[model samples]
Target: MEEEIRVEFTKNGFDFDEEEVILKKCLSFCINYKLSASDIVSSWDVYSLNRGLELTVRSSHMGAFLEQLQNEQLNKVREKESGLHLYSNDVAMILDGEYEEVKEDMLDTPTSKPASANKQPSDSTGKISGSKFSSGKPQESVTPFGQRKSKFAVQSSLNENHIKQIVKVEDHTNSEDDIIKRVRPNQKCTMRIMSSQPKPGCRFMYDRIDDKFNFLENRIKKQAISYVSAGICDEPSDPSIASQKSIFAVGMICCEEEGRLKEKPVLLQSSVEHSGGQRVRLDFQKLNQFSVFPGQVVGVEGLNPSGHCLIASKIIDYVPLSVDSSDDHPSKRQAMDQNLQMTNLSLDVPELSLIVAAGPFTTSDNLFFEPLNELLAYARRKQPQLLVLLGPFIDSDHPELKKGYMNCTFDELFQLEILGKLRDYVEYMGSAVHVILIPSIRDANHDFIFPQPAFDIHPADFNHQIHSTPNPGTFCANEVKVACCNVDILKHLSAEEIFRNPQGGSKHRMTNLAKHVINQCSFYPLYPPAEDVPLDYSLAHEALHILSVPDILILPSDLAQFVKVLSLEARNEGERQIKCICVNPGRLARGEGGGFFAEINYKGNPDSSSASIIRI
Candidate 1:
């Protein structure tokens, strides 16, 4: 009731009294008449309009108004029916002479604007009520309403040429001995994007369920073929059909209801080629152990006696070997071996040194790029050969951006704060340094899709040293294959997965979480992608495929930062086990404080190659 009254008073541009006697009287009237606060406030508005009373509520007029209200109700009852004795004449007499008296306390003019034109109801300190205090949590600059508004500011108001002004640290020599000497100091490592990245400003919206189904169906079919080719299972059959004998079936794991996965009522959705995309109940109760999520496509040797549920005898969660999509016939380990060949790496040889950092690069309090500047300063001193920066560069969820408080557009912000600084860093660091940028879904200036498009900004003028790739991207540094996805898949899968301990799978929780990406063979395997990520199904099928396991997997996540050299053993005889170095560089600036960045010495040899997660 008070909340409603507060809103009305705020809208009306009236000062809310400290003692709140007027507010108390309004509450009293509501209790007596069993009316809502809005109704009572509306009556007060009508009273003010009728009598030409001052807009502000006064104590003297408040009591008389209450009496007048009671009298009006009694009069209405008397006119409608025979209820004369139910009302009291004493209440009607209260307004006889006191109605003449009313009054002020203009309360002085407010320091800030106080009226209907106000955008956010709450301030950083506290909420504003009427011209005073409002009830609720104090709000930061950001609002929940993510209205896609463009033309935030004109070009004249923004500094578009800030990229030219980034300065290098004094006494910072660009010579060999000046570089930060390490175990594997530095070397020539060319960065090449491997995946078919989405173009900047490409379409990702208006996707229907069919587009989504097509991606899932394609995955199931591919997995089925892989299982068969690897000679691990028989030809795939429909689990939905009735069979007394065990059959080789390939399908995706799903829940019966539209919610989190539980043990019972698990369902398997077969591909269109085999089961016409049919869904059947999965009875895992008979099986002692298993691990599955909604989007995982698996081969199962199982029986469906009643045709309603699949009773599994053995489940193949992962395809032991991978087929090179580029090749017609498979070469077990030749392709991967060729990619990993860095020739020779002695202790004295110059190795590839890189600094990997993710965003929002600025602190939440302001967009000053202090943390980013610090990172660049550190990078310049270190003089790393390669620099990989991921985005939410101009974060949409940023308080200032969401509140529309900045004097420039999102594009302008990115140009000034991120791209500008990066261009400067490259120029100062000289030709030896190359930068690889990957966009995030939260990047306001770029396309907000999971298989996100690269930033539209051109970097040819910067000696072609700086460039961008789509989210969930794969690239090569020298001969070392690096696959990096800006999306927080570890956190996403952690929230959605029904993880159970399978045989020989017990390890670090972080490793287990990250292994899902490699084992599932997709950058993002969550069926219904996280509520926050704008997973574009049309582009995801082509973009999300991890065709060849990368030598280094950069999966930046909100989870705790680590540098793990994971050993994924090949399940098939012909294929060789892969040792992948997974690095979550963490965010350079976490919330309002500094976080971490990864300094990678990519020897491309897991035994020799090592990474350290250093605090900013």
Candidate 2:
């Protein structure tokens, strides 16, 4: 333990040349307090943070720092005796960056006696045993003000598969089975990653966002035109202008205030050219059932009787896609199938195995990164062809980070703790293994924006085996194209969206949220983007657009972890009915306990793919 303390001090910029006094004090504190070496190091950081000074290398300042820490320990005892509890309001005070205000309030108020004198002392890790402090406790589950989540029961399924193999990603399509191709190791990596919208540390104009929104409106209108030609939708009219007769209109769905979409306040903001980005309240009382959220571009057939509101008769949430004409030519397909059998040909396709995990990689109770280390261990053992890691690697919301307890810059922390292990993993695993690192807006070390840019890596760290993509980016692993965005869009949408007669339970309701992203062709279709998401509308057109529907869409969230297969209702001439697998590999660490990851094996089509959610 003494050696560990010495090493920690050295890492924190202390050297044994004249720092033995500091090391001894740290050791003594650890022994006296029953804190681990890591805890002692964390204490030093907290002490420095509170003092508003860099950690002193000189032992001359050590006494004051240790004194402050000792005081904090005494305060904890007082808190325990008083049985102080932090209600939601107390949490809000910290989130609002009013720490001084909270301190003043505490000073003015007297510590009250315990509500229950019978209450025993709480464990140090709150509830979890063997826990240590992380930077700060960032509320992963708390939604921003105005964005409130209503209680809805999810038809339980993900819970049943906890710690068990879901086994296979089966294609339930009624079509005949396709030909099987044998799996083999690839000579070179064919994985293609696309992350072009925004560059790291780049600047974007706040004005261009309006233009981008205008452009998106036009884009959706163009898409709707095809439906118009197919007689599926009538030509769109301006919902902004007064129209009493039933008219089909197209526009983006939005909430009037900075809150959830209830029935009355729903607004449809039309394209610039049509209604000049004007918004008209939408009355959904006429429609029996529908789901609506911000940013969802829809073609609605409705009457605008008062010119102030559009009473929707029917809502077309997404444009339709047609399957290829070959389905219309069954005989020709059968002949081609026979010809393949007669030729006795072989099409050796590469089968892919993937391991995907999302972040908050460390358990909430500590910065040990035990969960991440374990995940890496699992990846090393599995040796999957591809490993996808989503970020907030160093979560900005952690309680330690929130309270300014860190001793290092986020970048240095990432390089040392995150990339260091990854570097070793790649070196040991060799080039055969590929890793994809996608950043989140919540990653403190990275740029902060939706369609977030990739993390800037050192030139030395830029190896072929590891790749970085923007948040809400896409890539191909062999023939499987994947779209991944780290934001908890599921939670965001759930908080904001309003639905009625949702055919499926909350599980399917969650899937509908995923559907909104694909249908709108944007990674985050919720308009008035969630309070936490710093969505620069300027880059949104390019960054948010989904050029092609990926085979796998990874939308990680606080919601239940599940692997689901979703199919499109529309069919396009060139493309078949689009079907993709959506996987939410929950967080690697859920609060203090372990969370989940996804193991995937795909042999070309949805029919041959298999996926499961497993506990870490």
Candidate 2: tens digits of C-alpha lDDT, residues 4-102: 887655544334435667678777888887887656765654454323343345577678867867877886675466443222101122332454454
Q: Tell me the spans in candidate 1 whose CA falls farther than 4 Å from its real position.
A: 1-186, 325-327, 330-351, 502-507
Q: What is the lDDT of candidate 2?
A: 0.66
Weakest ten-residue segment in model 2 by summed lDDT:
121-130
Q: Highest lDDT: which candidate?
A: 1
Per residue, candidate 1 scores C-alpha lDDT tens digits across 1-616 of 7666666554333445443776777777878888775556556654653354544577778767887699768756644563222210112321323322210112335567656226443221122124322233323324321111221111111112321221232233343355343323344556666765676656768678888988888888878878776677778888888988888899999877776563236788999899998998877656676777778888888889999988887787765544553334566456665644443333444347688899978766556566677789888776778889998787766665545433334565566567778888877776667898888877776665678877666865774778777788877766667889899887766555554443344335567677788877889888877787778787877789888677789999876677777788877576566778888887877665677788776653665665677777
TM-score of every prediction relative to native: 0.68, 0.65
TM-score of 2: 0.65
183 Cα displacement, candidate 1 (Å) = 21
Off by over 4 Å in 2: 1-188, 204-216, 219-226, 229-234, 240-245, 305-309, 322-350, 402-405, 458-462, 571-575
For all candidates in order, the CA lDDT equals: 0.67, 0.66
